[model samples]
Target: MRHTLTLFVTLTVFWLLNSGHNTVLMTLLGLVSIIFVLYVAHKMDVVDHESQPVHLSLKFPGYFLWLLKELVLANISVVKSIWLGNSTISPCLMTIKSSQKTDLGIVIYANSITITPGTVSVDLIGDRITVHSLFKENIEFLKAGEMDRRVTELES
Candidate 1:
């Protein structure tokens, strides 16, 4: 019930924000759209925690900020490597154990690694994730476990 309400409210807010119309017609249309979506979601039986993820609302902002900072640092590192030529690059494919217990947490961590400029999540097998990094430094950054800890916190 709570998840359903959360999903409804979230979808409605998104509709209003994205629609950018405050008139009666737009408001009514948005309300109808939200109701139709809720109806379909109810029929689909996906109005659950995995679908809505309301629990992640508060934690995700901080994680996003941290990830943005990491991306900037990674971008700088990549540019520096380019300027210094390919000699500075030491590409490696390695597997690391996932500290997250939930599939959502592991996915967020993997996507975060993949989007961070110099590293990509190649595969996830069981609790281990295979990562390909453009430099040894990027691998060391992942091995430090800071992003893993932050993502685990977001999920839990």
Candidate 2:
């Protein structure tokens, strides 16, 4: 019941914030839609309580700052390599270990890796992730385990 209420409230807030125009009827309609969604979710039994860990807390601001810095650095490196006009990009496949204990955490970590520039997660099995990096330096960074460590910390 708590999860359902949380989902409904989240959806309602998202709709209200995103809507350009405000109207009493529209707000009531949005609330109704949110309730309908919750009803459907309840009927489907797709909301796994086990997946929502109560103790999990992420330092989102720090993670976002770190991610932004890494993105900027990656963009600079890619631009430099492109301007050099040589085959400076070295593609390599490497495996990294994931320290996240939950399946959802592992999925998030893998997806985050794929979302970042210069690297792609090709496969994930158990705690191992196969990543394809555009450069050997990127592979080395992964092997250094900094990314994995940060993701594990976030998962916790």
Candidate 3:
């Protein structure tokens, strides 16, 4: 029930922010859209813990900020490598261990790796995520598991 209400409120706020119109007709239309989305989501049975993720709500903002910082640093590295030439981009594939206990945490960790420039989470099996990195240095950074540790923090 709490998750459902949270979803509804989040959807409404998202709609209002994106629409930018507060007229009665616009509000009604937005409400209708929110209801339809909520119905479909409920029918699909995707409103459970993994999907709703209320437990991680408070911690997500901090994680997001950290991700943003990592993303910027990665972008700089990629750009520098590009400027240095294609020879500087040494691609490699390797698997890194994930310590997260929950599916959501694992997914978040894998996605964080993917979202950061110069790395892609190719496959996740058991506690390992196979990653393709654009540079050898990126693989080394991933192997350090700082991002994995940060995401695991969100789970608990």
Candidate 4:
């Protein structure tokens, strides 16, 4: 029931933000659309009730701050590497163990790794993630397991 409500509210907000109109008719249409889509989704069984993990709403702010800091640091590292005279690029492929108990948590971890500049998650097999690193330094960062730890903390 909570997931259904969340889906409805999210779709309505997205429709309103993208529609760029403030008419009652359009608002009513958006609400109807949300309800219809969610109903169809529920019938299709695409949204598994068990897969949606309950999260601490208060932890999101801290997680966002941490992700922002990592993004900044990664940007700086990439820029420094570009400026460095030597071509220190050492491509490495490695498998990292994912500690996330839920599929959503694993998806978050993989997406976060891909979002960072130097690393890309090529494949996810069970609890193992295959990552390709642009440089040797990036490989070290992945091996440190900080990303997995942070994402798990957020998904809690």
Which one is best on TM-score? 3
Stretches > 4 Å off in candidate 1: none
Off by over 4 Å in 3: none
**Tens digits of per-residue lDDT for model 3, 68-133:** 998999999999998999888889999889999988889989999999999999999988999999
Q: Which ten residues in a row have the lowest lDDT in candidate 3?
A: 46-55
- Model 3 error, position 124 (Å): 1.4
Q: What lDDT score belongs to each candidate, Candidate 1 first?
A: 0.90, 0.79, 0.91, 0.81
Q: Which one wins on lDDT?
A: 3
Query: Tens digit of lDDT per residue, candidate 4, span 40-129?
Result: 989987655443333545686787788788888888877787788458667789998999987888888898888888889999999999
> Clashing residue pairs, candidate 3?
none
Candidate 3: deviation at residue 127, Å? 1.9
Model 1, position 47, has a per-residue lDDT of: 91
Candidate with the larger TM-score of 3 and 4: 3
Ranking according to TM-score, highest score first: 3, 1, 2, 4
Q: What is the lDDT of residue 103 in candidate 4?
A: 82
In model 3, the number of clashes is: 0
Q: What is residue 113's positional error in candidate 3, in angstroms?
A: 0.3
TM-score, cand. 3: 0.90
Residue 143 deviation, candidate 4, in Å?
Answer: 1.4
